[model samples]
Target chain A: MATEAKRTRKNAQSGIFAVFREQEAAIRRFVRRISPSSSDVDDIAQETILRALQAEREREISQPKAYLYMIARNVVRDAMDKKSRSVIDFIEDFAPESVSSHEPLIEDQVDGRQRMLLFWEAVATLPEQCQQVFVLKKVYGYSHAEISRKLGVSVSTTEKHVAAGLRRCSDFLDRRAAESGLNETRRRSAGKGE
Target chain B: MTRPEALSADAPDLTSEAAAWLAQLETGRLSSRDLAAFREWIQRSPRHYAEIHRLAELSREVNILAGMAEPLKAAAQRRRAVQRLWSIPVLGWGSLGLVATCALAFTLLAGMPDPAPAVPEPVFLVTPVGETREVALEDGSTVKLNTDSRMEVAFIKGRRNIYLEKGEAFFNVAHDAGRPFTVYAGDRSVTAVGTAFSVRWTDRELVVTVSEGKVAYGEAPARAAPSQASDAGKVMPASSAPVSSPRTMLGPGHRLEVSPLNRAELVERLPENVLSRELAWRSGFLDFQDAPLSEVVSEMQRYTAQEIVIADAELADLRFGGVFRIGQTDAFFEALELSFGVNVEQTDDNKLILKSVN
Candidate 1:
């Protein structure tokens, strides 16, 4: 019985460590994405993880990965809210990778920089709503709570907006891929047809 | 929200569509529904996520380029302007606000200022309308007061003193040990040994709040504003021995207030981040927390001619919490309308009024 209790504690501790190692890079990316001050990236990353732990303690863990990411996202926002950098401007210059390098690898790796820029132009031109949501969520550093307060919307609304914006933005990228010569649609359809 | 494009046996022009959407996102504008729809579409495909990641990466680089070039471009413009002025001195004089503007431009390009350059004067500065004054202080605390605000520096032995006679101010108080610094208004004196804080005072009352560290606070002598023969002012006479009252300690979260009738006292336990809103004026951003619409508009009016008038008494009292970019009154009202579902109308008299809709 003592060993079992000890084991559970150990698992919880390991789980916490695994979560940090896994999400540290992504959270750093998120902070860099949103933080105006590059120097604050590490501090914000630390804060995001700490806040995620605090949040996890209060709630039941259904999906730890999603939950932890959500906490990290919120931490970014809370810091922003406290600092009041909620409003995302159009001219903000921050590479998404500077936001975080936890992005999906392109199977067809070309000049990494050019490919990324091509994609950024497409995303940058996303409708204003999509851009703001993506920026607020991805850059300019806001949690759903902070974003909602700044935009005068609800947390759910911010989430929905971000999700939808991501979906469309992803679709836009697929078209960009096709335009750039990769027949993503054909590839997807072939995978589906198989 | 726009529905996602269904996958046809033959692929459509996904690249153009994707580019358009990405462009929209980069521009930082899209309808709420559109944003939601886009996210949904992204979830529909692994390809979508890859593309977004790719695009996000690109945007990041673009931003870096822009940020890097920003200084060069600004410097180029400045050089050109200076060159142009060399040819034509008369054109230079037309740029009246150019000096401050150029200083700011340089600061942004070079990143933050050097500690000494950024270290402002300890003596507080006050500027009248259409006039600007910069002060070099002893301890190197730089204070910039907007037009019409009054500020004074007085050192009484161990205490560094500042009195906000009127209007609003931004205080970047240099950190120091040994001597405690305090800004006095009405009945409350906002005291700080280190870190930055802002104090705003009006004719009716005074407010002192802290941004960083803890502020050693005592009420300024809340005495009646010398009354005229005209309006009967509501005020309580303060005893000269009010200093005999016990000193009240104010931490960051505490908002200290004292009207003439009331000695400077801890009025509320506000959030420690209250300095976020108090010091916003420095950034040209005005943020409020359950702040009155009338007060918000009045503050806005201070910076611009466009006045916001509250139509309903209750609406006037309606609290708003959000950061408004300095001079972005239109965006401010739009957010208000979106949140409240109210109609904002511009009156003939040029006042923006918020009216309740059934």
Candidate 2:
């Protein structure tokens, strides 16, 4: 009976791995989209697969792809929480070299400043109410409920404004980046530069 | 690639769809069905992935720029002011074209004071009993004032000072090396450059709890030595005062209590659960773990106007453990009566009296 159980366990492990392998590239892309640091993408993806395998052993995962992505989101959240704590530690410990190394070069600073100017211009192009809602929700980190209460609008209205603002601003940035040929250079240098 | 051609054809719609998905995710209230649908949508096409990835990058960039919240806010206000100006039916201004209008706007803007980083009057923020408020400061810091709290905010050129007159408040201080944030409570003060901490001040004692970063808790140099005001100024400048009293450096999960009457200081490193429970009031809930009934009653009393009197000492000593919503006095009393063999009486004066059943 023990041997039979072991055989079934091995078969389940292979089955889960097979599914994970097929979706690994897409999973990595999803992780890269959500994670703040590039270095953490592989580790988070691996952790997600392991968690999925463990969960599959306990029960059948009806939608394996969605299950994997859900696990990936949770793993990313946990990693972010831990990373924030370590960031606090880094600030407290005060490593001069580590701090200096993170500072952008002069050219990068100029590039960042230009992009910020373009971003503000994009925000300026938004409608009046959309601009207000977007600023409150995105910049000040106000909740949708708070924005609705303060502005005397419904929460759903605020959500719509935020969505519209994001859509317009992203399109504006993309158009400008393409115009200046910055996107081409960025793609060549970093493959997926922000 | 063919992906680019396909994306160009449906770029606008795809971008809008991605943005809507992102906004939903930002709410942090997505149902399981929503997640499943989102997964299926993203996997439908590589173009979907590319669109979302681009928008997510833009979102992150915007978040980073949120550190300049004050300037961005000022800019938005300026635009609103211009629009308001444009709507006015000023004579002869209607003939001005867009360029002329912009020039006039610039001249008008030059006449006004610089709105960005302008020093404003002090603002007083208060929250009544059974209510809490969150205020975002001009400097990007946020303060959550608990029930019955009174706080005065004064932000100057180089300092951000908050006077907590009564009750408790939590501070999420923005990082500004040039401007240090300080909270003055009674004779003691807590200073932080960039950190998150909460301070509670009553008549007799002060409690400081640090949840993130670090804070320095010490006696206010100016207030502590009022007798030697001139000497204190000479010996310790406002910026470079070497505190005579011991300054406690508190990190995450550290709780410090100082009592003026006894001149006692207690520093305890609370576990994660205890720390979270202590700070749970921020979330509109009070958590108790095997605390005495009297302690629980007193804590609950902070949130309500009604008085709770324990008539029997034994009844007050009964250990109770439960999580309760703040200001739910009726439910709390009912629970006590149901489980602790206690009876609650309402007096003629609208006071609640707890009595032993046996």
Candidate 3:
């Protein structure tokens, strides 16, 4: 019930857009679950959100994140469908300067867990190229082929990056949870607080 | 409740399933067979079903997005089509967009005026064969629409222009210097500032003969079809060329003819009686002198509904000299039988057989 106030504030401030603003990060993460290429995640996220909004506009929806993830799942399939292409969609040298954040894409209410702070900081230390592929494939739902084509790498190279990146992030999460003496309760509460 | 390791293996299975589904989806015009296969695939596993449902949801979403963008694209495309339509010159009726629907609506709304312009400048007007027609003009003047000919007229300001689109018309143009009457035939517009002139156009030729007063000639672009008839009907004079090859300024009694395949040729100087020969069509008369017999039988067909057949090609080249009325062709047939050794016999249904009886 206390989180309700935060939800209303976020919703009231953004109007009909609150639903998408709330789940943009998770849907992107779901997209990464299938996509190994990080560059295409933002596009998939935008597409997923646009589609989700349309579904919402067309028919009232109760589960916003579920609906968004559903769209994200399809986007993942499409990204994978495009993955058959061995050639990269973008330039090999092109790299974004900013680190992608999995920190709650929506506003984090002050009364929530600070694990997100540590959670996202660990995400920043990843090797730039590996981090991007991992997020796009593992978090955003792009396929290994998509990551390879977008980053102009071999499919096997994309798979390695995604596997390595996720392993590194999981390791980081394990370490943080151990060092901070945090449990699933804290993680879930942290998710709820955000 | 499950560890993240379980989720890692799931990605490839999901990826492969997605690729397969997409390939099957693109197999051209969606069919019941495709749907049945898809349903079977969905029934294969709970995960597969879940994924298909997810994808179906995705396609639905993209369609809505495309829908939102459709109106904008349609409006832009419509604007472009209108710009292209405005570029055509045939309808100088103003404005770039005389939309077909709007034109139809306007025509209906503005009910057809009871009486349109009476002098219908037809796209093509032809006269009879072996017959010269003197067609009186709206003015007290007249133009002898020659035999087996066609002509086209277009009006521009004070200058009334006739494109002997094909065929010839001799103009007894009303004397008006303010507006030069022009006959536009193959490559040359014979202009009469206030004069009398004869201009004929064929598929491969065009000729102009001027009598009484000097006439200025302007050349038109060569046409595909040129004229075949001559200034003097009976003695066509070896398919006479025009009097001036370059169509130099013409004085009274000058003549010019242009072959479609060549530059203009100097035909002849007209005698004072030339007008009677050219204007004989006004009196329904056709004259022939040493003219090919072939041109005669062909000419015989037009006056009567009956078709005339010359049995031999040699008969066409044989020259004959005669003068007779053209409209009542049966009488002329008798005349031909009497003058030339040509016997006319009746064939079935509007057909007449001709024989060289001599």
Candidate 4:
């Protein structure tokens, strides 16, 4: 009986590792998406998979894919906390001139305006009802139930409207970005000719 | 180059799918099964990760602009006008209210300079057939114009006035105790300090529907004396009217129909559902209950270029009832043919003739 138990434990360990091997790339990608500035993406992803495996040993993970992503997100958060602490320490060692001011930088100001323009342009492409639904929910911060009641629509309809709005806005922004990039290249080539 | 071209062809669909997922996640009510499905979806391709990452970044940037939610809402409401101005793809922000809001938010956040004050001007707004438009005025009021509508807005000194030249319009007047909001339609005018109502004018009659606070509806005071002929056809100043006329006060759900020729006025109190049905065109729908086929055809004709004529007089009074989209003439025709045994024929002049099947 003791030998049988040992064999079962060994098989479970191998099973978890095999699953981890299959999901390693996805874990890394999720980590990178969550914390794009992090340089330790691979390390954090590996740590997340190992921790997930440890949890699997304690209990059955019914949805292994979701479990892996949830763990990856937590691992990224911890990594960010550690990095922010180091950053704070570095700032503490600097002089007054080295510290950034409370006021936003000029580039940040430009970026804010750009973002506003992009948002408005993207929203303009939606239908009137969808636009109203999106603005009420995202800008006015109304709950889905409140929006449905106010707009005299069903909650399910409101959800569909919101999803449609997001998809259209995303597509609009992507197209605009691509078009502008193409224009920039064209202008550069023309300037070279001049 | 071929590889990149192939990827770009399918990129938009993938991006939209990712955006849908992000929206679901935002609802904060996703089940465990949904999360598992999302995981499976994301692992399908490396492109999925890229699309989600791009959308996530875009969503975050949008949240940052939520600090100026009022302006964003206004922009969304006036999307048609913005789209027209922005069609050039050059970044020229046309809405003064939006610019002011952005400047105010920027000033509060980054100590930026304030934008110049906007000068009040007479703005003429028109909507084509089968279309509706919503405009947000500087005083926080919103006007939703129905299909094929025309209106002129002028705000000066102590008063706000809207001239409904043609078609119908609904106004949600912001509470401004100092200024009374008035809409002038044909021979009638409706005035309110703060209320929500709609005014519709045709050649033969005028209709006013009050959905919110009380409003006074009566004959418009005569235009200012000819001495101010320079302002003829222009928005008259506030001091033009000294005559006091009898005005009828209307409460919520009250609809007043006035015939200019006969000088007859009728007021009826409508139920909530009926009122919503009357105003359904604001949301691009028309609701009818046991109405005559002629009335439905005329109403539907207003939203389409095609003229609908009843070939048989017997079918004119046929009772038809249903809710339909305003501009979907094909679907309406299909329903009529399938359910009502009506045969629809199209003529070369873009007219539709309805005839009985038997």
Query: DockQ, per-model, please?
Result: 0.02, 0.12, 0.01, 0.09
CA-lDDT, candidates in order = 0.49, 0.64, 0.48, 0.62
Across residues B1-358, which tens digit of lDDT does each residue of candidate 2 receive? Answer: 1125456676648878878876776666679898788777766665565556555545655653332232233445545543543353221212223322322211211122345454345467778887765655666677777888876675666767776778999888889988888887766788899998999986647899999999988877653322233323321113334433537899999999987688599999988668877887765456676677789988888888988899977656566655444544565776565434468999999898998653
Here the TM-score of candidate 3's chain B is 0.50
lDDT of 3: 0.48
Which regions of candidate 4 fall more than 4 Å away from where they truly are? A1-194, B1-120, B224-239, B242-246
lDDT of 4 at B134: 62
Which residue pairs clash within candidate 2? none
Write candidate 1's Cα lDDT for B1-358 as tens digits: 0123553323354433444455455434579998777767656554444444444433333332121111111222333332433342221222333333322312212222244322223233455442223333345554555545766555434445665667666565667777666666644566666765567776656666655567666535553432223323422222222232337666655666766464434457764245444654553345565576678767666655656667766566555555444444555676566443346898898877777532
Name the candidate, 2 or 3, with the larger lDDT value: 2
Residue range with the least summed lDDT across 10 consecutive positions in model 4 chain B = B103-112
- Winning candidate number (lDDT): 2
In candidate 2 chain B, where is summed lDDT lowest over 10 consecutive residues?
A: B103-112
Stretches off by above 4 angstroms in model 2 are A1-194, B1-120, B223-246
Model 4 lDDT at residue B150:
76
Give lDDT tens digits, candidate 3, residues A66-162.
3455566567655554542211111111112231112342223321112322323333445667656544443334455666777799866665564
Give the poorly placed runs of model 1, Cα more than 4 Å off: A1-194, B1-138, B144-148, B154-159, B220-246, B259-264, B267-269, B272-275, B288-295, B298-307, B317-322, B334-351
C-alpha displacement of B275 in model 4, angstroms?
Answer: 0.6
Instruction: Give candidate 1's error at residue A52 in angstroms.
Output: 31
